[model samples]
Target: MTDEMNNAQEWQARAESAEAALSRVQAEVDARLIRAELKAEALRAGMVDLDGLKLLDTEDLRLTEAGDVADAPALLARLKRAKPWLFGVAMSSSSAANPPRPEPPRTRHANDLSHEEWLAARAVLLRRR
Candidate 1:
């Protein structure tokens, strides 16, 4: 009930509020640091987009950091299992830089075998396999 005791209680409340704010700010800073670290790791592993890792959840990021994942490729493999949208339809590196080789057209030979011979040859191939 004393004035000094009342002031002491108010100060204690103020200290707790400050501590909570500090903890919140620290958490935000730590999150930013983690995102930056993940981006660096992705770049080192030759990933094209570091921001993709930034889109991952905290738990996913924590698991990546804790798991036996070796590089961004491995991390991406796991993330793809959960978020297939991260990667659009897969494409072989046959982009315009290295145009895709046109597949050779299949054709019957000039000295073609009859159906019976072809059947026998197919059976032989299957057995060989």
Candidate 2:
């Protein structure tokens, strides 16, 4: 009876430890998933810096059954409104609203010169000196 009791207690302790470890792993995984979701949402919203995520209050955020942040878009929108400096200018879907600027023709520079061109220029410069 004594041996049986000791064996049962030992098994219980092992089971408890296993449960604790499993909970820790689950918490870590959930944290990682939440971070990933927030990052994706932030990128989509044109967040200039990822560090802006640290400013967010995650206490109110809930996780969906799919393991995604439920109020992620809303949370990001609030953050963007609160701290507009953290995000870049929002891109418009229609190019008609803002047309692309035309670029002027690029002038040739010393860096653009080939070996032969460089030698000729060097010769001309040396003669002028």
Give the TM-score of each candidate. Answer: 0.49, 0.70
**Would you list the clashing residue pairs of candidate 2?**
none
lDDT, residue 92, model 2? 69
CA deviation > 4 Å runs, candidate 1: 59-77, 80-129
lDDT of 2 at 105: 86
lDDT of 1 by residue, 26-124 (tens): 777666666666666656544565567866665544324443333545666676676666555657676667666999987876369898888888899
Give the top-scoring candidate (lDDT).
2
C-alpha RMSD values across all candidates: 12.2, 6.7
lDDT string, candidate 2, 1-129, tens digits: 999999999999999999999999988888888999999999999999999999987766767998889989989999999999999986768757666689988887999999999999999999999
In terms of TM-score, how similar is model 1 to the real structure?
0.49
Global fold similarity of model 2 (TM-score): 0.70
Worst 10 residues of 1 by lDDT: 61-70
lDDT of 1 at 35: 65
Please identify model 2 stretches exceeding 4 Å from their true place: 92-129
